[model samples]
Target: LVVFLFKQALTWIFGLLVVEKNLISYPYRLFFKKANKANFSFEYFIYPGLCALFSLYYPKNKSNLLKTLHFFISTSVIVIFEIIAVKYTKLIKYKKWTWYWSFITIWITDYVTHAFHKWFFKTKFHE
Candidate 1:
């Protein structure tokens, strides 16, 4: 209900901020002087959207320890897979590794959004 809406709103705000920052600085720097490629690829949107959805469905009673462990494990696993995929196959290149900032940003953004949602929804943090 209220929590869901709050999460959605916060997610939208964070998404906009990321886009603006990329467009104003990162994209220009990556493309112009660096001669690096930059574009609105699928991962640009997918990671953040997945983060938002995960936050929305997070267990309310999960202990803080468990939640933190889950976060690290999940992030590490994804990073490892990406690294392997880039290294072994030509699926994604090394240059694209920097693009993972989107994942990190979304991770932080989702945590903040979850905090706000909890505060507004009167949800209690466990452990």
Candidate 2:
């Protein structure tokens, strides 16, 4: 729950920033339609849910190679969806943003969130 909320907050802020900068846009929004350009569902809900799942299932005791693989796979999956959304849907449209940018940011933020999660429950999480 903590990790979910934390990721939600982080993504929410960044999402708004990206939209404000015209790097991304959402033609259809489920919330805050008249006041915000960001997609509330994806930023505040889907992404946080994904981050929570990623952090919870991270292979903490695994080898470095496996850990890297985990990050690659998770980020790739997300990028794939974003690419699809960009190509086929009005839900998200990239202005100055690219798929690689999504990949890089997701990778970095997920790493940070995972680190925070581990630190917040240090004794409970073991490598």
Candidate 3:
């Protein structure tokens, strides 16, 4: 419960920072610029923010190898979803897939946040 709240807080903070910095426009500017039209919104930013927070709270009760595997699996799943959401659906669109850099930024942020949270909380594993 406490961890969940912490994750939410972190997500909100990052979301706000992205909005303030106008970094959210990077996707549309870099990739979706030549598209028939652009549909940029805060939703795109919020989802990744939440994903980062959730990744940070991933379970840590398995062996080290298992835990690492779980992290990779979890992160990959989120990245895949993001790709699909932005590419196939009207949820978000890009003129070109070169927008991969934006997704990479989100991925790295998620991994870093998860790692930072695990360290700050002293995540423990058990048999």
| lDDT tens digits by residue: candidate 1, 1-127 | 5544554565556544544455312332222333333323323444555555566667668898878876665566556665675567654444323546645854575577667766776767667
Model 2 compared with the native: what TM-score? 0.94
Q: Each candidate's root-mean-square deviation in Å?
A: 7.5, 2.4, 7.8
**Residue 104 CA error for candidate 3 (Å)?**
6.4
Error of model 2, residue 6, in angstroms: 0.8
Model 2 Cα shift for residue 111 (angstroms): 0.6
State which candidate has the highest lDDT.
Answer: 2
Greater-lDDT candidate between 2 and 3: 2
Q: What global local distance difference test value does model 3 have? A: 0.54
User: Each candidate's lDDT (Cα)?
Assistant: 0.53, 0.91, 0.54
Quick one: RMSD of model 3? 7.8
Give me the displacement of residue 88 in model 1, in angstroms.
2.6
lDDT for model 1 comes to 0.53
Clashing pairs in 1: none
Evaluated at residue 123, the lDDT of candidate 3 is 56
Residue 111 C-alpha lDDT in model 1: 71
**Quick one: ranking by lDDT, best first?**
2, 3, 1
Q: Candidate 3 has what TM-score?
A: 0.49
Give per-residue CA lDDT, model 3, range 1-127, as digits (tens).
4444454555556644554455443344333445422222333454545565566556666688876676566657656776776766555444433345555655566666666666676758655
